[model samples]
Target: MKKIIAFLILTQSIISCSNSDDSADDNQISGGKYYAVGSTYGKNKDNNFTQLASVWIDGVPTILSNTASSSVANAVTFYNNDTYIVGTESLNNGNAILKIWKNNTGESLTDGNHTVEATDLTVNEGNVYISGNEFIGTLNSSIATIWKNGQAIRLSDKTSEANAIYVYNNDVYATGYKIIDDKKTAIVWKNGVETVLTSEQDDLESIATDIYVDANAIYVTGYLRNSFKSKAILWKNNSPATLSDENDFSQANALFVHNTDVYVVGCHIDTHQYDFVGKIWKNGTLVKEINGANPKSIIIKNNKIYTAGSGLDEKGMNDEGKIWESNLNNLDFIAKYKFPNNKVNAVLVK
Candidate 1:
């Protein structure tokens, strides 16, 4: 189930323009200068990895942790006027969970009791919403769920899952897939109602991987499978737009919209094997590749774009995690560290 997928999911990182060395001197307008939020890992063989929520200011690292433990933070969002950083902590226990830290106060909103694991979180109008799967029976069944103020709101009563979540105009949107008759169907949930964004036509699996919200639009990004390959897709208001040009396997994991422009990051696999090349698309146009990049989360702040993800090494382990700043007009690795092959799920500015 999701537990298996969570272990296999590649981990990913982040760096903002102000925090990047190359753009450290760039005189650009920003939101009074905020720091990027993400995690860091030590080594794969270590008993546990430190799930870090960091703040980078002028290319310096500021660590934020409520408690000292080896937890993996999947996503982070700054809301309620940047007073809180909401994300999930993979406890290494059977149950991973959704927790919030109030601006480096070392205080958690969860109260450190329940093991409710959250993946993606957002703050809207003083309200907090997080998306991820919750364990049904001591890590037995993971139900697709959303939590509002630490209260569970189940999306699928059965063995279903929801991963990424966003809030717009007082409405919540989440995406993942469901198991129906032993087949997976791509789905989106809005205020507890499920909508099938893609069908299980001909054993072609489609997953609604990421969700982005704007003033008048909602963008969903993922992949649509076929007999030969899986193509990257972006859904704007439920309308589909294919991104990949070649007949290769391309999947999008992160999405963002700014100033009426769309931005997405993911990987495109080579025809031979699991060798995925990192890809970033702007407004459905192919921009560039990271050569062997695998992006996990993307964000837009201060009129700049930032991405956090990892890439494969010669040993085939996803060890190198990178962060890029777009407004600086440079796509260079801001930070790189060694860890197990993990996936970075979210990014934010604090």
Candidate 2:
């Protein structure tokens, strides 16, 4: 099941600002720096679609890989003025290889021994930490794995996957889920110690997509299945706080903590229309919504909220990467960047 979802989930979507006072120039704050990594699709001379791994810094895009094979840049971070990107590349043998790129130089993390992927990465004190999973055994069950400076650390015995990673005070934290009795169970690992975040008695599926740790709290955001629908949730120090109504299926993809407030970004599926609507919650309250978008990552800096994700195209057949900036006071979109024919997976603001 984890493998199925891993192959299905592509990337995150868009918010349009309506206020006349909100202009595109309002999003362009002086001296503000931002970085985003993702995959862009382009047509080749043969009229074939090709995937190009790319990174964008301050609205400028740099292609990292544009070969015949498909590639993606899933996550990006900066350390000591160097940019690092993590994602997957397709090999000629039809195997997916996990890769890390620093300053446009590529490093293979997997030798195509098995299907693997790098979901998120963080750099702390010159040490690079990555969260992902590798298939093992004949069943091809995913194992939750973290790499510290290229060293592998397995955090789960059963089928699992790590979607996000964070390093705080030299402690490694990963958020994902493990399979227990064929049920998805949300979990957070701190220094290789696992703590389940969802209730076992519910027998419903749950997953933790992202994790954030501040001086005062540890926050994880995802969703828990309830009967016929899923509910978005934010867990702080193992305590669950529901962020969406149980009547609709919703999932929180990422979260950030600023001062005393918690911000979460994700999407909710409308049962009637089957449309996915992007949403953001502040301190467990729904504060914004974007039609035809699904938010994946968020950051709050200098009293501004920046979110990166994807938005459905006019035909609703493809998704395009988008970044939205909003003022913290009114929460209205001030500026937005759209990458047509691409999907954004992660974002960083510094």
Candidate 3:
């Protein structure tokens, strides 16, 4: 059976920061401090392409050590003033290796023996948890896997993949999907127990991209495919809430809950023009939209909302990493940072 791959668009757009300077060693990029992790690509002297894992501290770019092959930094977090990034690095034998960077030092999670990718990461009480998928056997079927402190735990029986992970109250929650009878089913695993979030009777394909837990409530965001279109969906304690209609293709990539209000950020695809429009929904209401960009992750700091991802450049030809900030007092974007030729998969505020 052919695999049904789910693509995630990571883009965002807002005003450029005025404090950007030409200094290469500056610790801050846009007058404020923020950390972002992603990949940077360039052409070698022989005109061949090369990629490197990169992390930015307050806008200062730092290329990670492993340059043997292409690498990507997928998620970033700060725990006890130490930075951590999770992603994958390619080996010479054509296998992808899961790797984590702590304070700019790279630690390989796999010995390049199997294919693995770390999509999201979280740290709780000094314990690190990373979520993604690992291929099994010659069939290469994906198995949703979570790694805690370098220990691997499989979460799925058949073909599955994990996108986001959260650890709350000493319980680990992983959000992703599994192939049941050849159809993808949205699921959440709490302490290794599986809970199906979508029903087959809906007659639509679904996926849960990100998960969050607050107190006693659990929230998961993604999209449901209905015929030719997809609609963004949010599940609050297993209750489904539609964030978008069936008119267009949309998915929620990340979400945050603050003071009983839920905020989700993702992308809506315009079929006619093939454009990806960044969107943010607040409590099931459309809050913001931007063309040619996709919001990947969101966070609330100091009562302000910030989203980090990638967006089309001014010429609309190439994509660049960007960060956008907003608040309830000002619904409009307040500040932004753009780094050319890079894509930010995650963001951390200090």
Colliding residue pairs in candidate 2: 12-309, 12-310, 13-309, 13-310
| Span of ten consecutive residues with least summed lDDT in model 1 | 13-22
lDDT of 3 by residue, 42-113 (tens): 543344577678888777888784565678788876666677788888877888888989998999889888
What are the runs in model 3 whose C-alpha is more than 4 Å off?
A: 1-32, 43-48
Which digits, one per residue and each the tens of the lDDT, describe model 1 over residues 18-88? Answer: 11111111112336443444555442234445556544443354555434454444555444345445555
Error of 2 at 103 (Å): 1.7
| Every model's TM-score | 0.76, 0.87, 0.88
Instruction: Order the candidate numbers by TM-score, best to worst.
Output: 3, 2, 1
Better of 2 and 3 by lDDT: 2
lDDT by residue (tens digit), candidate 2, 62-134: 8777652778888876666677888887766666788889988988877887877778887776788888888
On lDDT, the candidate that comes out on top is 2
In candidate 1 the C-alpha lDDT for residue 117 amounts to 57
Count residue pairs with overlapping backbones in model 3.
Answer: 3
Off by over 4 Å in 1: 1-34, 42-59, 62-69, 89-93, 106-115, 226-228, 270-274, 312-318, 328-345
